[model samples]
Target: DLAAAPGVGVDRPRSPQPLVTAAPRADLVIWAPPDVAAALRPRAEDFGRTRGVSVTVESVSDVRSALQDVTAPESGPDVFLGPHTWLGEMEQQRVISRVTLSRNQQRRLAPKALAGARYDGQLWGVPYAIANLALVRNTDLAPQAPQTYEQLIANGRRLKAEGKVNRILLQSTGSTGDVYSGYPYLRAYGGGIFAKTPNGQYSPGRLVLDSPASLEGARRLAELGREGVIQPDVDNTNAVPLFGDRHGAYLVTGAWSVPVIQASGVPYAISPLPALPRGGKPVPLLDVDLFYVSATAQSPKLAQEFVRDCATRRDVQVRLARATGLPPALTAAYRDVAARDHHYAAWFDAGRDGDPVPSVPAMQAVWGPLGQAFADIVAGKDPQHSLTAAARQISSDLP
Candidate 1:
């Protein structure tokens, strides 16, 4: 069980039985982010035409907030798309229902992606795509991928010395700090938000941010800060453009930024972020995008069939990957698309090697304190002391 906090819901165990009820027939409606809606429209139309089931896909400005009225008959869509992070709270609120997939359907998607859809031992959605951060090198500047973080830093320094680029790495360390971007460094030094069970479930009680290895990771981060590697001013808004403009030799970003970089006409290559000299491999955070059925859906059967059958098809997954620029969660579709797009392949590879963001409600408490601690370390605060304080604050914040 996760602790309840203001603005954050607590995870509650629910009966595993599917939610099936008597209701009038309704057109299956889906609310998706603009990009996903655009991708899903044609396929949805095809499904409605062939199956004689009415389907509508709405492009929403805010995908995350679309679930606030999930139980409202007039406002709620049958299905909604969002990251797996929402599973904890939405499940707690009973706004989303469990999705039952056949054995074949389960086997069609990537294992990690399916794992992301499960919360408290029940499937909640159908994962559509996987997103993870990777190293994007400006081929014009770096020319080759560095095998390790040390070599990357060394090359960055060399490039910096020649007055060719102003920034070593174009990554966001925003005003409040970005734990998502800083996650690789933390993992490389053996620090993580929580311990995981043998089968890979996050154990909320095992908060490890203040452990010895984590403090060492923080120390290394502060060392990089003092050495002028991690800059204080660079943020999410500017990092992409600065890298596109050749202001930086390398960029640590996700696949979503690829189109902008391509539009800038900068030659780039994608690869996983390198390991540290004496630490474990740097594992980026994986965020799986899923289509969740609303618990109070008017067309529950249609929504489940569409997500489980139509949406997971190879052609549909391929089209979705094209539109979203994310690797398909479907294994065969990913292999098909990855064969043609090296960039998407790199992202998929990174996601396979990365840690899925913990979907437990306790995770909400982690972002603020850990992010602030990272910012403080970058601002030259003592790593050990700062992390200790952060850990203490997070424990207090936990329910």
Candidate 2:
């Protein structure tokens, strides 16, 4: 994971010595995913060589382990790369250092993306990428993506009558994926997950899970699932794969699936989530991941410099775009040649107008009840009862 830190110096003498040393030592260390590490290592080496700094590359297995090592006194990294949500927990624990962005640098980022990095009035991380849900449709099967919730249902019924498909794809693997994909529908129907009070506490918003609009939405979704419009195995293990395999005509997915979709050679088009039943716009849930500095690091200055380099540097942003297929967090990088040619550009455009997922600490409470509520409703439980029960649970769980 040390290799994942942006602007890690590699040019110092005995660079290879660190790798062979009994105990590895380096000017900087980073934590990130394997694929991101693989893509970043060579470039980082190049940057290090140019600057004459010796850097060591170490790969940590997962986010949790990486965070643990980075927070440990002896093994901590100078920089950590992961989701911005980590900031909420890390900041609350006083494990991360605050980063102050220049006005211009902040201006270059999407507003919602920037908001995700801000926790407790300080920006904790530099965002590398931003993603959100998009409606993907097989143009061959359905010439046009639905423009509204009603239209989507109508199209589903027509296609089912003709025996073209079985289910519309909505991810429900866990609380996170379910909320990301399902909240748009709930919001479109004029429901919200939480309400913020003047004192900064979050209250349970109107539990509209069983409202006419939510019921209408869930019923449509359940109808699709029941009529065989969706695959029977869509419980959790393989809903995404079902869509990737072309078992369904429509899916709500993020840009992360670009590689799989391309490899599958499936002909598809992207559109924003359909509008809600009352004609309100559908607001896709946007997820932003950010880079953060560890407070215990040897050099907070160096860590902040590295984050700034990662956040604003064109080369780093371009490589990030190439590696992840996610839109670069910076406006200037969005115009890079690589991003321009990617077929997912329309989805990124759609995401520009979407809503950021709630980032407050209290936001965590919304996950469990919402997931169970949706699952229960889909399993044929009474919608109003299911939603009311979930809301009560959520209210009790909120901080």
* Leading candidate by TM-score: 1
TM-score to true structure, per model = 0.92, 0.82
1-399: candidate 2 lDDT, tens digit per residue: 122221111110111211121155577666556556656666666655776665444554455444654435557776766766555657777778888789989998867788778765678888878878787777777688788756766776677668776665545433222555556666665565654457433344544455666656655555544654433345434555666676667777777765666777778888887775446666676667677788887656766877776546777777777777777787777778334675547767778676566655555666667766666655556767767787778767766
Top lDDT model: 1
lDDT of 1 by residue, 303-347 (tens): 898888888889998999998889999989998898998878888
Q: List the residue pairs that clash in candidate 1.
A: none
CA shift at 95, candidate 2, in angstroms? 2.0
Question: Candidate 1: which stretches are off by over 4 Å?
Answer: 1-26, 69-71
Question: What lDDT would each prediction earn against the true structure?
Answer: 0.80, 0.63
